[model samples]
Target: MRATFSRKAALLCSAALISATSVMAQDADIDSTNEDFALDEIVLKKSKREIQTETATSVTVVEQDEINDRQASTIAELVDSVPGVTIVNGASPQGSGINIRGFGANGTYGSDQKVLIQVDGASVGSEELYRISTQLFTDPALYKQVSVLRGLGGSFEYGSGAIGGVVLLETKDASDFTGGEVGFRFRQTLQGSTNGNGFASSSILAWQPTENFEVLGNFTYNKQSEQKDGDGNVIGNSAFELPSWAIKARGYFGQDREHSITLSHTDSQVQDRDVPYDSFGTTSDNFGNVDRDIDNSATVLTYNYDSLSSDLINLDVQYSYADQQIDQTYVPGSSPLEGGPSWPFLEPLVNSNHRYETSKFLVKNQMNFLTGGVSHDMRVGVEVSRRERLDASAAPGGTDDRLAVFVVDDIDFGNGLTITPGVRFEDQNIKGNGTYAGDYDNSAWMGGLSARYAFGSGFAVFGSAGYTESMPIIDDLGTPLFMTQSEKARNYELGFSFSNANVFSDADTLQLKATAYKTDIWDITSYSNADTVETKGLELEARYVHSTGFYTDMNANISRGEEFNAGVATDWRNSPADSLRLTLGKRFGETLDMSWEIVANAKMDRSTTPTPSFNAHNLRATYIPQEGAFKDTEFRFGIENLFDQTFTPHLSTRPAPGRTFKVSVAKTF
Candidate 1:
């Protein structure tokens, strides 16, 4: 059955690709002979705003349109499609973990999260001793843009513990709904999936009292039952119910409305029953269950001054607060024979509940300026955070206070060459109020340097090297507090980008980017300096677009990671797998867009036992009414795991979903 399904998918994809290519070629030949074509552009802010091509780091940007195109239910689904990145799935509502260049794939504490998640200039975390999963906890519809920074995170402007990388999420603005005129707008959407009988609905409202003043709000509800794997067997403990909402208010001031302020708040919660025990824990084979509830809320206030009067400087200031808590009750389940000898004796000692809470308050400023004959962009900021374990289990609730200041400078030399350098200094203290806490003060300085040279319009080369000294969080300083010193990392990377508008034809465009990097982290999970972990990898991406609206993209990555022992590496688990993704898409007229994607992975040797690889296919389509009665309505549909191959993702033990169909409808007025 699998073979037959696979062949059918292959045939359909081939036929669609050939048909679309032929039609697009003829259409472009006549209508786009003199037209200009180029790949999509991505801009990110590390220390300052810059195009991805001009930056010395690997960056991936997912725009709001792409998010809508995929109809992603979670942030993990949106990011996992990017090259060189992975967010482990399986856990409902919230994903398990996020891995960047083979980091942040282990540990329970939220502080152990290697990748930083930022939303609208504010960081997100639960700060629980058993930290909540970093990705997929919030609804994807709340954000307008998601950007991933690979390799060295550039500067300390984003706070600490970003030795792996950083993820920046930009939330939707009232301006996104309200045009330049003052009015009211509303949007409604409904989506459903077959695998888990999942359903979701969202409503958004925006009101512009004046051209320069606007308010927006969004609410969403999501629910899913048990999911079925590729073999048509139910995957236990894969059900959840979630609700999320957000509100924003912004106003423009000053003569030309160059000065602006924004205030926003977001809240989300997840409820799940029969939650499975951690698959990576000491009770790996245990069949225990828990009733879980997690909640997260954040508020941010921002002010911006563009300085229309002076070209010397522009300023942005922000203050944000975020809090999260987890509540869970373990339920008795069938005794596990493999759960050690104590499982049987403790079978009746269930129904216990635990609570954890954490919060953070941060304020920062970004200053852009030009000094002397050189252009400089800088950021200065400070942050404070606290975490507590409400229901003491092993560690008592504690408070951690920190004061941090950081500065980064992007210097332009004018001759197609630019250099970026930065440093951060922090003072941190941990106070134990509940169970275990000692008065300790820690300080450290982190710094990095990056350079990029654009020799021509479509070609650029870049390189970077950096070191980060990150202090332990409250979770890391738990119980016995086995760790005393801060964790540190040395990172380096080099890459290039190329683009051509006439790669295949005058009306066609092509772009390519490739990068390689290596990172050595000290004291990642130990106090001993002799323990070192190293990760290295290469990522490549290529895209081609025809003026007639046909496009294709290929992304691939491979790497290796391990712990070093006297210059020798052991227990290597790098590169997860050599994987490649190919996508073909075409737009029909002004109403329809269709796409097909194939993902393939090569076998990987993660341990003494190698993991097998697999291939998967997906198809999606979107339709919009251009001028008919349904002009303001849109429809979308897709099929995932077309072949229904029963395979697991590399570094993951949970089985992926089977062939599932999903659809959605939306209307705006």
Candidate 2:
């Protein structure tokens, strides 16, 4: 009966294709849809809340629509196609950390986090090994947009220690569902996947009691069983459950609506049981199951004021608090000594727990004015944060304090050119308590310069160069010999962007971007201030869309990492392989749209270990009733891993799932 049900699901997808094309002839008669039309002129913001135009560094933006279309439940799934980004431990049930330019890639027991995660206005997790991945604990549905900055040169506005880059996530607001009017809205969604018979349910409520006041709330629950490989073998101990919730409130004051306040809170938790393993990916192959639980919670408050008369009064202030914890318990199983007598510690149940807590405050001001016929946009900001770590077992834990101030200016030459200059100063101090008492302090100065010039032929060139310094995190500090010179790096990059609205026809469009960069890191924190790292890479991205709703996208990268000791190149443990991703799909209609997509990834010659490549093909069919009781309801069905190919990703121990089906239904009232 199980086999028959699986076969019928596959046949239903094939039948959907046959029926969708027939209805497309009539559905095409509708007016042109403005969806996915923003192939150019994307806007971003810095930590100071200043607009970052095209002259700024390279960034990848993913919207909620795209996330829904791909059913990306985890951060790793959401960013797999982005250049210079790799997901380590791709098959683990407990989340995975990201590697940007080989910065957060190598570790046997513990390693410092080079890639930072900023949610709302606070950084939440710890870089220590055995800690939970920051991005994975939170539900992806809570975010409305996700942005990824490629290198250090573009990330000075945020706090230090982002040698790899920064990932900023923005949450949804009440106005998103209430349509800026006085009303109430409620939405409920149910989705499931066949990989491990996983199921999820989410509900959202929004209320706009007055023209200037609104509130929104969301709750979600997720559960899954053990997943199976292509050969129908269970990846043992890979079962989990998650519960998440959030609340947001916004208020607009002042007669001219110049002042606003927003407050939000989010909480999420995950519980799972799995086998214990170490660096080589097979340290405890014959051990028992390891039960684990992770929890993360945060709260943020923001105040904004826009002067009605002068730009000098434009201001923003925010405060936030966050806490994260991980708990693990190990239990022995039968034949625990299959390897040898070298393992005798698995006698009874062992338990451990760790926690990280942080608090932050920020204030910024922006001024736009003209000076001698040249326009200038200036911004100034200050930030302060305190972090604490806790351990119940024989591990390292401490507290740290950081303070920073920065200034930035964007000058327009009024000749299709812009110049941007920025500088920052940071002071960091570390303190240890509880039986271990010590102190360390460090300070540094960093700055960068960037420029962009647009030609008359739909092309533009941009480049940036800078020097940056970062202090060690809690885990990296607190050792007996505390030497703190701070990690420093020199970064450089060059890139170009091109866009054409009419590529082959009046309604067709094409966009392309290419970038190359080199960075050298001295006084490395992980290497105990001995070795230096040099990393270089080239990235390319292209997208084309036809009037018939057909589109193709491509992203590719070539990168390498090397360590230097006394100016001699050494084999680094975390060198990335050349990888490529290609995606092809078609949007059938506007009202009752159907999408068929194929996503594939390939790589060769991995520096750490040898591995095979993998590909996944997916199909999505969506239905919306135009005039019926279900007018506002949506239904979607899809299938993942169409070929059921058995393959493993680099640095992964288990194989990915095969031949999975998915279904979702959503209704709003």
Candidate 3:
């Protein structure tokens, strides 16, 4: 009920700092027609995504309403609904990796991730071992907003060479429940699923003692038995028991409340006893089962200052630290221990403890001015981060430090014409000690230009081009290969967008956005022998809504690419399979709404072996009364994989979950 959104309307309206309307700090009305579902611009009391109807970028924002309606059991199910985004090894928490446009790192032995995943703007996740994951793990119930930017445009402020784009997860604040007023509120949700026999209990408590302060805390407990495919085969290492909690608080000060400070922390963990050693797709005990305890935690402190009378002094500062620790030990009754196996199993591996941590400090400011009769909005920022890996069971340990400065400017020359330019200067150092003592350093620059022209007819065209580079990291577990140079890439994107109202009737609206992109990267990776890789893809999004409650939303994506070594194709994993999804829905008055979604994926061409294609269907519904006894309560039901298709995803080895029946109820007090 607290979410407001706008689609990308122009190329220069940075989605990271969205603005809805001119007004600020407005109360959101729940159980009412809160806001437009397809607005040309979105503003949410302050801190809203204001992508206009003619936006040219491929930025997608998800609100709390959709999150609740999905009833997702994990982050994997919550995300990946977007086109060109896929999860690697999604069967278990230990290996659910992120892949965007075929450019993510996972199912590998080193931490060479290309995608940037962050919670509250704090980067997280590291993959240095064979079985460890390179994705963040948390309770989705703690978040209020989810943003996904799909393209190579994030390298400037998000990372050194994040060609796979960025994912931002924003947690719910106390103001969400009490509407920024002095009050106390609590909400509880109970959910159950049939296929995996999964059950979850989530609770939240919010309090605002005064107009200047607010606080919120949430806790969740979720558990599941081994999941089965449509064919009724047990998924390997798919069951888990998770307990997570988050606490956030904020205080406002200074004249006219122009300054504020916020502090937040979150912790989540999972414990598995005698699970499959190959958390991948294989159920065969090639090595053996083990006991694993994975814990993830993060803490963040942020400050914001905006001048009420001036438009140039908008500043933000943040300091954050995140850690992911995995402790796994040999099981006495496991396959290797019981069978007394040979070869690798005879190497005697036990009590393996690995810890990955990230510490970051960031400062940024925005200013508006006029130059040469053109209106300009400029933003500049500095980022510093320390990434460390500590391994006790064989994998190598090292640290990576990065310092970067980035600046972007939006120049508007009237007549619906806006051009944005950005640049980044970065330096990175990776170091190891003792037996693997070594140091690698690199400095690079990245920049790009984007232009958009919107006509009075509600149609827009935009284009962008940029270049970036990726620095080297520490060597893998016992591998002796190290690189001296960084990987480089040149990226290009072109798009068209249109938005119109009263297309079908006086109460209907339509929006469409499409993009085509290509990226060329050259360098030697830690494990790969390829010299160059090129990827190209197309993404499309379309939606239509009417006053009668009938609506439809659709997304389609196609990706293709290849890696070349001496003119011979060697790898194609950078190309995700083509995917499409369509959702149709209707609102039965203000008390109920329902949606049916159909999703399909084409077989992947990323390897020599052919990965099969598959399709799925889902149904979802939510009911909330306006003036009845259930005004403050909600009930939801869903059916996923409705046809029981037993097919695996292109990037995953485990079969997809079979037919799942889900139901949940939430009550507010």
Clashes of each: 1, 0, 8
Question: Which wins on lDDT, candidate 2 or candidate 3?
Answer: 3
Q: TM-score for every candidate vs. truth? A: 0.86, 0.86, 0.90
Candidate 1: stretches off by over 4 Å: 1-51, 107-111, 127-135, 279-287, 333-364, 387-391, 478-483, 526-530, 565-568, 573-575
**Candidate 3 lDDT (Cα, whole model)?**
0.75
How well is each residue in 551-609 modelled by candidate 3, as lDDT tens digits? Answer: 78888998888888888976576466789988888877656878999998887766765
Tell me model 2's lDDT, rounded to 2 decimals. Answer: 0.69
By TM-score: ranked, best first: 3, 1, 2
Error of 1 at 182 (Å): 0.7
lDDT of 2 at 397: 72
* Top model number, lDDT: 3
Which portions of model 3 show Cα errors greater than 4 Å? Answer: 1-54, 89-92, 109-111, 333-351, 475-483
* Per-candidate alpha-carbon RMSD to the true structure: 9.3, 10.1, 5.9
User: Which should have the higher TM-score, number 1 or number 3?
Assistant: 3
Write one digit per residue (lDDT tens) for candidate 2, span 520-594. Answer: 888776764247988888888777666676667777777877787777876455656667766666655445555
Cα deviation at 543, candidate 3, in Å, is 0.6
Give the clashing pairs for model 3: 7-51, 8-55, 9-52, 9-54, 9-55, 10-55, 20-42, 20-43
